[model samples]
Every structure is written in structure tokens, then in C-alpha cells.
Target: MTQDKHSRRRMLAMVGGALAMPSVLRAQATDPTVVGGTAEARRNISSFRTQRWEDHFDSLGVATLLADTQSRALHYWSADGSDYRLYPTSVPMSEELTKRGYTKVVRKRVGPDWTPTQNMLARDPSLKYMPPGPDNPLGTHALYLDWPAYLIHGTHDTRKIGRRSSSGCIGLYNEKIAELYELAPVGTQVRLI
Candidate 1:
């Protein structure tokens, strides 16, 4: 009967759609969502580019952070002659930090505590003190540079890495910065060009 065939077709379609819905839900759950205030989505896969082929240090034996404002990425060099596979990281940028020149690491701290600057608090009093943790702005490690206004540090939100959303200091993915923190000692020179 025509009526019976139409009912059977509608039931089959509903069953098929219902079976497919869970897969779509699972994919959305697995994918990471946006965090903090990032303009771009986070990328997991990265290919390293040759920033410098020769050891420009000439075996001076000091790790360095070569931060490029234009690229919004930081390149790390090991004084020990070990080459690291490249990972493109998102770096924070602002109008004032376009030219930082060269600065040295003044201090280093792990699980660094974060307190909003008086200047920051003045502007946004609603911002509260954030304790150190996975949610902390400073993330796992922080390397203070000679410039008090800025430093090289890790971020809790991996999404913010490639975005120009930080107050001023450059931020790296948590694992990347942690690796650098262990390798780079205080007084390591950081050049921004």
C-alpha cells in the first residue's frame, strides 16, 4: 500500500539519522574549543624552519630566544649543538612591543605566582589575583627578562600562543616553555628583531 511504504521510508530515515548523531557529537567533543581571547584556532601540527643553519654563536655555549615580531614566533637555540625539530608557536604581540631589541633573563621561576600589575588593576579593577595552576596566566614556568614590563613565559591556554592577546610579555605553549626553562639558565640573552 502507498501509505504503508511512505511510513516505512520515514522510519528508516529517522533510524539512520539517529545512528549517525552520536558520531558527530563525539567529534565535536574530541576537538578543542577556544580559550582565553584568541583570534585564531590552535594548531597541533608544526614544521620547523631553518632560522639559522650555522651556529652563529660559534660555540659560545649559551641558549638564546630569537623572537620575531613579524612572524609571531620564537626560535630556540641550544648551545650544546643539539638541533630541535621545529614547532611553530603563537606569540603574543602588541603596539608597544614591536621593537624589544635584546634583553637578558634576569630571573627564572617555576609555578610562578601571578599578581596583576598596579597599572593593570587600575584599568580593570574587576580582574582578580589568579593563583598558579593550569588556569593561571603564567602557566608552568616563567623567565623574567631585563625588561620589567615583559618576560618570556608559558600560558595555560594554548590557544593564546599565536594570538596578540597578552598584556605585553611573550607566551609559549606550556611544554615548549617548560623545555626552554630547563635548558636556558639565567642571563641567557633574548633578542627581538
Candidate 2:
């Protein structure tokens, strides 16, 4: 009887240990480089928590963009309205997007230099302008909008995607934003809700 009790206890303990392994594995999975991931390219990628293509708007017309602050996702529609795709993005954690509704792309830049906004400088005066580079906060491309002090740009940091982590700018992954740069032109309609 004692032997049977011990065997059951051992089985239960092993099962419990197995159940606990996933959380441990997930934590380890997040940083492949730090976790000694040789093929750490996978960890460097960021994604959206949710994505779907339904009639998400009254009119995501040709050459239009819809940035959802709640989901931290960006959806772009083509000129002909044939192709619509979703991409993960990061938005301002603290910046109020009060000037919402309709806006348009005013200009665009490749490998854009990042100048700290007045608000940013207010928090840290020493943070001067950042030159364009792989490490530049505005990763590879940027689409400046008519909205003052706002931009849709790229980031070297993939960890911020699908999260509220930006100072007010909308950010995408390097690869994704590069693709968006090609698709979005100057004067494209952008709606932020």
C-alpha cells in the first residue's frame, strides 16, 4: 500500500513538472540571442496579438491606412483596393492621439534621421538628434503625416511591436515598414482610430 502511494506521488510530481515547463520555455524563447539561440533571427521578429481582414472600416478606400491604437496594428489598402494587409505596430504609451480622424502623408524618407521631439527633449534634454543607421530609433523608413509631430516609422526594436511603448509615433518593424514605404505614397489617406 505504501509502495502504491509513493508511485502515485512520483507520477503526480512528474506530471506537475511537465506542466510547469512551458512557461519556463516561453521565457527562454523570447530572447534567442540571450538564450544562446544560434538561429536567433526568429526571436528578432515581432508580431500582432490579433489580425484579421473583415470589413473593419466604413471605407478603407484605395491608398488608405487604418492604424488601430487599441490593437497596435496597421492595415494598408492598395490603390485599386485589391490588396489589403495587416502589419504589427507600436503606438504611444502616453501620448494622447486626440487629434484623431482623417490625416494624410505629407512626406516620406528612407533611412531617416530621428530628431527628438520637444516633448521628448523635455523629458531628457541631453537626447539630441539621432543620425540614420541600423541602430537609429527610426529604423529604416518613415512616412511623415500631416499630423504635426507624428510619423509612421520603423524601429530596430521588435520587442515593442503589438505594445503601447512609443512616445507618440507609430512604429513598425524594419522589414514591414520598408514594404509599407513602397506601398504608401505622399498624400495617402491615413485614419487613426
Candidate 3:
């Protein structure tokens, strides 16, 4: 009977130890790189003064403007802005924007198609692209801001929008961007303040 009790205790100890191993390993496996060892990374994560888009509005042929409150970055588009599109830096179309009276929202797919490549883009370049159509990253409509290689468009990344989410482009809901695109004319000025 004593032998049986000893054996049971040994089994329990082994099981308990096994269960604890994962947590121990996880705690030790934390990457030091994520702690922001580099100066650039530190700057990227630092907080700045809050800014509102409405604060700066120059009616001098100004058509539209996209502003990011978090990053204090602005993307300005003019009737003759360029003929391309201007994307906001790190601003995503968010629910907060909608709740705050932004009736028009655009959603687009601005990520890579392949899973592995997409993951690579997220980790390394921090850049995203809109897919071609409905499944495209640039959702239903894209607000062409007249900037080469930049666009204020809708995104399917509903979660990422409204936050400092994108690499340097402004993101919106697919539907909203389309609506805005229709309303905004070619000469419409966009100011990202």
C-alpha cells in the first residue's frame, strides 16, 4: 500500500511539472527586440501632442483633407493635387470615427494576398496594399488623393482602421470610401491635417 501511494505522488508531481513547463518557457522566450532597443523603434512608439483635422482648413482651392489625431499627420489632396491619391499616415477607418459623426466609411483590402508574404509585410515593411476588387484590400471605393503610390481608400481591415494601423496610408471602410469618392470631384482638394 505504501508503494502504491508513493508511485501516485510521483505521477502527480511529474504531471504538475509538465504542466508548468510551458509557462516557464513562454516567460523566458520573450523577444528583447520588442522592448525597443533601437532608437527608431522608440521614436515610432512615443506619444505626441493630440491634433484635430478640423483645426486646419484653408479654403484656398482646398477640396478635402485627411487627418490622423494619433500621429498628428495630415494628407492634403487638391483638385490639381497630383491626380494620384494621398493616404494618411497610420490612420485607419475606425468605429470611433463613425461614432464621432463621420457618416461615410470605406473599407478596403490593402494587404498581401499570400499568407506568408502578408505576414512578412506586417512584420518588416509595415506596408499594406488593397486587393483588386470586392476581395481587394481597397474595399468598395478608393478615394484617389492625387499622390503617387498613396491613396485614401476603403479597407476590409475593419479592425485596423481608426488606429495608427497602416504603414503611411489612410484607410477607410469599403462602402464609405466609395461614397466619398463619388461626392469628391477630380479637382477636390484633400488636406491631411
Cα lDDT listed for each candidate: 0.70, 0.78, 0.48
**Per-model TM-score on C-alpha atoms:** 0.65, 0.69, 0.42
lDDT tens digits, residues 1-193, model 2? 9999999999999999999987566544233242364433122224332322243445544478888786577988887778878888998887463345778899999989988888788888988888999779899999999978789999999998888888878899999999999999898888876
Off by over 4 Å in 3: 1-55, 60-62, 71-131
Q: List the residue pairs that clash in candidate 1.
A: 90-161, 90-162
Kindly indicate the candidate among 1 and 3 with the higher lDDT.
1
The candidate with the higher lDDT, 2 or 3, is 2
The lDDT, on a scale of 0 to 1, for candidate 2 is: 0.78
Which one is best on lDDT?
A: 2
Compare candidates 1 and 3 on TM-score and give the better one. Answer: 1
- The number of the candidate with the highest TM-score is 2
- Worst 10 contiguous positions by lDDT, candidate 1: 40-49
Worst 10 residues of 3 by lDDT: 98-107
In terms of lDDT, the poorest run of 10 residues in model 2 is: 41-50
- Give per-residue lDDT, candidate 1, residue 50: 39
